[model samples]
Target: MPLSARRLVLIAAACILVGILAGRFLFEGLILAAAGIAVLAVALSYGPGSRWFSPVTWVVCVAGTLWTAATAGYWMSVSAAADAAQEVPAVASTLFYIGVGGLVIMAGGVVTAAVLRTLGVRRISSAGG
Candidate 1:
């Protein structure tokens, strides 16, 4: 597949994921969606031969992952407080789980990207030269 086509597919997938997340978590979902879009944009902006360990890419991935983790922590705390107060909503507990899942996924992605970059991995073109 061409790089452009692959990028388009990735963008489409990100949009779909964000939409689903937003539908489930409202404001939190929107925030996460924005983060996802930002990451995609950064990835797309790189040249085909760009180094994976580019400082900008690393910074974006690290920052985004940390942000997601912080948000997840907040949600967990809220759920715990509500539970203690006997006012816990089922939705709150569900959101907490979702947040944790997002955090894990994002963190894993960042780590994978970092490792790939450190190993000097490059994009493999599908079209045989």
Candidate 2:
């Protein structure tokens, strides 16, 4: 995998770890991890320039973004409820941050790749020219 993909995978793995250890939000973590793994696999097999890579990323990105937004909305509603508890689980906060962080990593990877290419920094490319 390219460096960008590898870094994103690491972030995804962290999300899985957070869910497992926290015993909460496992579904969300698994979704992010699976998407990350798929992205990495697609990038490696077809190369970043191949037609398959961007579509895979787009599908996963959209799904993950929607899921994250729904989760955030649910959290907001619960916190706003009349009977809402005063204290929130620390793990819940961590998991939320990790999910958002994974998204950021994905986006950052794309931007980094584009910037590097634009700047003639293909040395970081998997081809290693």
Which pairs of residues have clashing backbones in candidate 1?
none
Clashing pairs in 2: none
Per lDDT, the best of the predicted structures is 1
Output the worst ten-in-a-row residue range by lDDT, candidate 2: 41-50
User: What clash count goes with each model?
Assistant: 0, 0
CA lDDT scores, all candidates in order? 0.54, 0.51
Q: Report RMSD for candidate 2.
A: 10.9
Give the Cα-based TM-score of candidate 2 against the true structure. 0.39
Alpha-carbon runs more than 4 Å astray in model 2? 19-53, 82-129
lDDT of 1: 0.54
lDDT of 1 by residue, 46-100 (tens): 3224343355455555655555555555666665777699755456656556556
